[model samples]
Target: MTQGRSIRLFLVDGAPNGLLTAEIMNWTGHVLTGPRSKLSELVQRPECGRTGIYFLVGTDPDGDLRPLVYIGESDDVATRLKQHNRPEEKGGKDFWEKVCLVTRKDQNLTKAHVKFLESLLIQNAGAMGRCKLSNGTAHEYIGLPESDRADMAFFMEQIRTVLPVLGLDFLRGIGRPSSNQQPEPFTPTQPETYPLAGAENPRLKMEVKKHNIVAFAQELDGEFVVLEGSLARGEWIDLKHNYRHLYKQLCDEGVLVDDGNGFKTFVRDYGFTSPSPAAAVVAGRAANGRFDWKIEATGQSYADWQDQQVSAAAAQSEEMEPT
Candidate 1:
């Protein structure tokens, strides 16, 4: 689990989607984020002149949810951004719509330091398989002094934490667990080990005994988690073509393996953005997880419990308000 930490974000233009800056407590790193339209305004900031690593972000022209991203390090961020902002005929990036850059607030980073950071970031962004990276060149590792390497590694962690807060999750992991995170197994008989607290983010289960479909899931840390070994229907009717492709991709990637029982079983715990998509994967058809995924003990559907929770919170909040 990610340890709790505080992050501070400032709106440079007083608009939520306009030029913005962010910082983490006890961290000496500074982050600058802004939309493509605000490029001129951002270049005026002092951060633009610093040595830093920058990312250019844009939606994929192919309509894939994964956006296109380019990572680069520059001794002068402002100058680099200016070049990218020029018209395509003048060699500017045409695909990027937003930009984020990271630099040291204490002004201690050297060209080597920023190069190391750039190489590492590019490698990770490509490894995540989340977005298409613009850099065609493979990263060339840079050697750093032992102490400096430790410091840079810590700086990268801070960057990882701050990027998600600014709405870029390309660095967020999927499919594989971090080195420190151990995988937990899911077993039907040991259901007690599951997340059990109902009325407060309860664990949910969906099973069609006749179809031999059984799955367990919960929402955690902004993700809908379906545990490992959960059974999924091998054949789904009326499944959208893209969702079908998604399942096949999961299978091809070995996240889901054939169970030899006409079903696909999760080889490891999988997290989905929401229950509906998770349920649809398990059912091999379109599914409403809110109505179909049920609390194992109470037999209440997730939709019912969610309604009750919302109503309760509203009533409690009303009681606390001053008359």
Candidate 2:
């Protein structure tokens, strides 16, 4: 369980897109954010003179729509930022567009402290798989005193809590079930149903079954999750589509395995950007998942269910209006 956090953000230059400063309630750490265009102005801030860890964030065109980041730490963050902000031809980088740095408000963070923070951060970000890391080397562990280590760990915890609020979430771990967890724990055997928490609504949930093939799907957090044990078509018709690559990647990654019959069976849960793509890869051709999926309990189509939900919401809104 995670406790709540109180983060105070100051929008420097009084604009959201410009420089920004943030700090957690009762925390000694300070976070500063700004665009590369304003790096010169931001570097002048006092926190930039302190030893700290920083992230250079930008998008990677070849990375399948993932953000790219270069993580580094320096005794004088401002000087390092100045060097990086120079042209790539001049011992600088060319990819970053925004900068975010974390430092101690009291300017007491040391090289060893930031080094440990950098190594742990890189490892966790790599595990998250949400971004393309530009860092070519990892920092070796700089062992800290047991007491200072505990304090740094808590500092990292606060950094994690505030990162997502700043529109960065590369450190969030993907949802994965444990090894002993059943693939179809919600429903098993013939006519299996993969129930997801808060997804009981027919409009947003359904199971696809064709002959002996069965699959379950639900929308969560803007992504479609296909539960384990879901069967996919053994072959694909649109080989050039992006979903085809995705299917291949899933198979290569061992998330999907051959069923020994003529279809693909999911060994673990997987997430897709949308329902149609998920259904297409699962059905081996172009498919409209909105119409193909049906509620196991009522046999209602997702499209119809969605219409009913919209109508119900409008009616409720009308009822609540003052006459």
Candidate 3:
């Protein structure tokens, strides 16, 4: 044959949840018939089209992996290799290392599959997606090598085999199944309520503490203020709307008082400022500020307030939707 043919093989082990897997992969290797060797030689040759290998670990956009780790392709193989092996150097974590350890200890995986995996990993450099195997968890990109098509075929086969193992072994940190459904539309019970005009919920509960603070300072205080936190932790905006308009409203209403260096709120007379201690506290207490604070006039939660805004926006959009 003048041109080498592509060969792909796949095997899945265990039940509905795969315990193990294996595959036979051959791509674009020059036709050679000596003891099935020269595989290494084929890998070395650039013309053979060994395009390298990569692993795509499935993850949410936020970079959390839950289900399967996919091995595939790359252009800068050296960088990809370092990315997988050196945890701290590459984002302080390495998922490939974890999977390899498990595979090493568990002989359930086949020799061919193992070789495919080992070569695929050793050859590639950077990894795409989350590395749950690593201590720190986040999605990342890997640099792959340029070689031949054969390597690509081999790596893809290995990936196919390994994916089944995730389901069977019940890997904890693997990303959710690729087939998992997207979230349904969010429907709120009430949408007409707004947050307390101003409140600072600064108890620091970890979940929505920052949001509460922003809600309090921006929505309630009606001021344009920038809050700085720990450097790496970054900053957050309390109010989602236009800070300048809110600031103008507060200034025009005389609710914001300039105190030499910066500004503070005189919320008692201002309708925009929250009536409570902080926005965080209000958010934590109830979804709707009106109901949570017992502000009988609104009879709604912060969530309800959000819903009302969304509904109004949607209505406006519909009216403007080319009718």
* Model 1, residue 193: C-alpha shift (Å): 19
lDDT of 3 by residue, 264-283 (tens): 43433222224332332223
Sequence-dependent TM-score of model 2: 0.72
| Ranked by lDDT, top first | 1, 2, 3
In terms of TM-score, which candidate is strongest?
Answer: 1
lDDT of each: 0.79, 0.75, 0.31
Candidate 1 lDDT over 123-212, as tens digits, reads 667655567788986556557887987787678878877998999978755433233445343211221122322245567799877897
- Between candidates 1 and 2, name the one with more favorable lDDT: 1
- Give a tens-digit lDDT track for model 2, residues 119-152: 7778766655567798875766758998887787
Model 3: residue 168 alpha-carbon error in angstroms: 10
Which scores higher on TM-score, 1 or 2?
Answer: 1
Q: Residue 254 of candidate 3: its Cα lDDT?
A: 39
Report each candidate's C-alpha RMSD, comma-separated, in the order given. Answer: 6.1, 6.7, 19.7
lDDT, residue 278, candidate 1: 88
Which of the numbered candidates is closest to the native, going by highest lDDT?
1
Model 3 Cα displacement at 276 (Å)? 30
